[model samples]
Target: MSNLNFTSGQTIPNSVIAPVSADGKVCFYVYGKTHLLADVSGYFPK
Candidate 1:
């Protein structure tokens, strides 16, 4: 996501499912300040 702006005391929910490398790692970038929460219910076999 790009060009994301939020006001004070605003709440937003965003979910993303991305494939990771061999290390099971991912990266995210935001223009301004944001909070992120990730929950892994399950994973597929490698």
Candidate 2:
């Protein structure tokens, strides 16, 4: 497993989404315990 080494109060840029699911749920793979924030910008009609 790999880790995302980020500093406190740091902002990470965009990430890519692949193998999307029908339920519109996403999963993040982290190596250890950390805090996460996900913001949805828009939506697609089903």
Candidate 3:
């Protein structure tokens, strides 16, 4: 998720689809604790 942008019209908390970064390098979208399957390792890996 390099230089990716998110533009949503909904007034969401922004925490649910929290952004996660590894070593502050790769940033990816991650769902809340309820969706553990959305984890980085669960999908993408370095």
Candidate 4:
């Protein structure tokens, strides 16, 4: 359980957070935008 920072820009509506564990975990956060999947996925790696 750590801090994952992803997706942060003026064009972006919100941000995405991805938590990595021993087995590679992924989580999504929709604070403002959820349309930046491609941008977010680039950092999460699937």
Best by TM-score: 1
Q: Write the per-residue lDDT of candidate 4 for residues 1-46, one digit (tens) a residue.
A: 4233455554534444645677776555455554535354465455
Worst 10 residues of 1 by lDDT: 1-10
lDDT ranking from best to worst?
Answer: 1, 2, 4, 3
After superposition, candidate 3 runs with Cα above 4 Å error: 1-24, 34-46
User: Who is ahead in lDDT, 1 or 2?
Assistant: 1
Clashing pairs for model 3 are none
Per-residue alpha-carbon lDDT of candidate 2 for residues 1-46, written as tens digits (9 for 90 to 100): 2335676677776554344477866676755556676666666565
* Clash pairs, model 4 backbone: 13-32, 13-33, 14-32, 14-33
Scored by lDDT, model 3 comes in at 0.37
- In candidate 3, what are the lDDT values of residues 1-46, reduced to their tens digit? 3232334543323323344465555344554323212233333344
Question: How are the candidates ranked when ordered by TM-score, highest leading?
Answer: 1, 2, 4, 3
Query: lDDT of each prediction vs. the true structure?
Result: 0.67, 0.60, 0.37, 0.50
Reference-based TM-score of each model: 0.51, 0.42, 0.16, 0.28
Badly placed stretches (over 4 Å) of model 2 are 1-19
- In candidate 2 the C-alpha lDDT for residue 39 amounts to 68
